[model samples]
Target chain A: METLKINYKNLYFPPGGILMWIIIFLELITFGMALVVFAMYGSEEPEIFHQSRLQLNSTFGAINTVFLLTSGFFMANAVVEFKAKNVKKSSFYFKLTMLGGLLFLILKSVEYYHKIDSGITLETNTFFAFYWLLTGFHLIHVIMGLVILIWTNNGMMKKNSDTEVVDVEACAAFWHMCDLIWLLLFPVLYLIF
Target chain B: MKKTLLFNYGLLILLTISTAVISNFVAIKSLAIGLIMGLSALKFMLVSFEFMELKKANLFWKVSLIFVLFLIVLSVVFISN
Candidate 1:
């Protein structure tokens, strides 16, 4: 009975703690609903969606997917290293993770530049509107995630720092959420018309 | 554990590449989209379960997350139709 109670508590808390998990779920639901609506809009005008999707540069999208996923993997390793009390290795992995994120942002900026160059702003059309809005919101999340990762890494490296395991886990959880959101966005906005 | 994580990473990259190639090259539009979405779903499950450590969570969370996303992906399939 004692073990059961402890197990229940642990489960309730999760890796990044219960509050972070709640936020993750809320974010996921919000993105999921937006995607559903995006698909509904696509169904209404397949041609516009198809044409807009063609202009999207799927190669860029695919490369970004790789970037985010690779970062996510590095993040998982960082968490593991942290758990093992290997702060140096953990910090190294965190740096690699940030590099992945930086690569993603640079490439995304180029993609956005191309869109702007071609005069494809949010007001261009329905497809472009969703493209800019959904991905724009996601970009904000990625930026926020990078800030958290840097903070977490710096704190860990500081002597006598008070950074907790749960803090790192929370940062990682948030980072992976970006990956999850992009997973949906990539296919819906880029592949499926 | 690290080995397992590395394996999952490799698999995800391969799946991502294959899904992109298949969706782009396949002749049938609906078939291509369907296959791509299905593969996307698989990739989603892989990242959530392995990388996010959802596999270590309780049954409730593990099941809820998977089922919710699966349903959302299904809705996406129907929406694209």
Candidate 2:
């Protein structure tokens, strides 16, 4: 009897799925362009950007970095636990992952509130405009990511769990995209000026 | 796989902390900026390869995504300088 072998080399199914990877690439490109433009503008008005960056709380940015990275770690472990069919372990890890995300969001919201209280807005300056738009957009992605994680976790809790590996992979991929985007944004927006 | 995941997470956390601290305490402004960007790229690659499982992905996707990062980083660094 002859057996069939699926070659992933020529196939488009990367880690999560082709469709998901496509979205990742597109989103990266969009943000990548914006970041480059931001850098260019910073060069033009280095003082304004530097002063604005100093106003940004680097401590908040650093703590958020730890939160997101920790979350991503928990998320990867959840996927591992799920793949082993250890639903209980997976559920625990999933909760931890969500907690990390929740903490990040709460912190970010507090930072945003402080910014608003101080009258920083898109119209404040070029750097502030990019800051509000880029970080705000990334925050929205994190919210969507949390929604997806909750949905998948709920699926896993059902009597007959319907969440597939691909589904979880897709979810993790989206969540990590949030992390990845934040990595780029953190250094440039908060650190580099 | 478990060991690999743990190791990746460890390196990621280490890198993140170092980047933040170095940028905070480093005396040279230009040096700090360069180091931060470089470390950020390391974080990007770690998440993509380990967490996102791009190491298991096809070469095309892996290479393309990396190239994209390189371009973005290069442009930002050049203009910032």
Candidate 3:
């Protein structure tokens, strides 16, 4: 009888793991449903949607987009370094990624402040309501991603720790999903009507 | 790999800039919408395939992610129209 061999390395599941991917799918669907509802409401009140979009500071949205993308880039590099077993470099890159997240939070808070000062609250209108709900939910994800990245970085910095490669990859995957959600949100809320 | 990451970063920035310019300068509403959404999709793909390492993922994951994006974009475009 011939013995059968399984090639574990050739398994084609997503980075992180199957559980992470399942969570990612669910998150994406939730955001997608929110956005579809947003679009439907916009269609119902075209003029209001258009006017509300104009009130948004696209410049801020554009800056936040750059920050998130850059952070994502750093996170990607961190993962690559981790795969290469370069712990110090990976940790450094993860810190940079966290820096980007911090900047995004600061800028987003400023934008929110300006909106609130201008008397734009969630109850202001349907557009403002969606804006607050969608972006607020995403902000919570960013906070979670930052925390995960910090934990992963700490693990990487420790010598001979049991922090598996999958854990680091899972952190990166979650952070990238945050970026993905923002990419969709930016266009729908800031650019298009 | 470093070079690929750098290239992806540059491409993402370029796409971001182009989308902003198109949406701001283009007079035709449909044209602006089409260009902006198209660029957004392109950016989304770059991030997914590169930063998210979707390229190394299984067929099921890749298809699911892309399908979700397609549905969202289609829904937005349809309802807006």
- Runs of candidate 1 with Cα error greater than 4 angstroms are A1-9
Q: What would the per-residue lDDT of candidate 2 be over residues A1-193, giving only the tens digit for each residue?
A: 1123324365567767789889999999999999999999999999999999999999999999999999999899988887777777988888998999999999999999999999999999999999999999999999999999999899888986777777778889999999999999999999887
- How far is A46's C-alpha from truth in model 2 (Å)? 0.6
Q: Per-residue alpha-carbon lDDT of model 3 for A1-193, expressed as tens digits?
A: 1122222234445677778878988998999999999999999999999999999999999999999999999999998887777888888899999999999999999999999999999999999999999999999999999999988788767766777777888899899999999999999999998
C-alpha DockQ of every model: 0.64, 0.75, 0.70
Residue pairs that clash (backbone atoms under 3 angstroms), model 2:
none
Candidate 1: give the clashing pairs. none
Ranking by DockQ: 2, 3, 1
Best by lDDT: 3
Report how far off residue A29 is in candidate 3 (Å): 0.6
TM-score of each: 0.95, 0.95, 0.95
Best by DockQ: 2
> Lowest lDDT 10-mer window, candidate 3 chain A?
A1-10
lDDT of candidates 1 onward, in order: 0.88, 0.89, 0.89
For candidate 1, give the lDDT of residue B2: 98
Pick by DockQ: 1 or 3, better one: 3
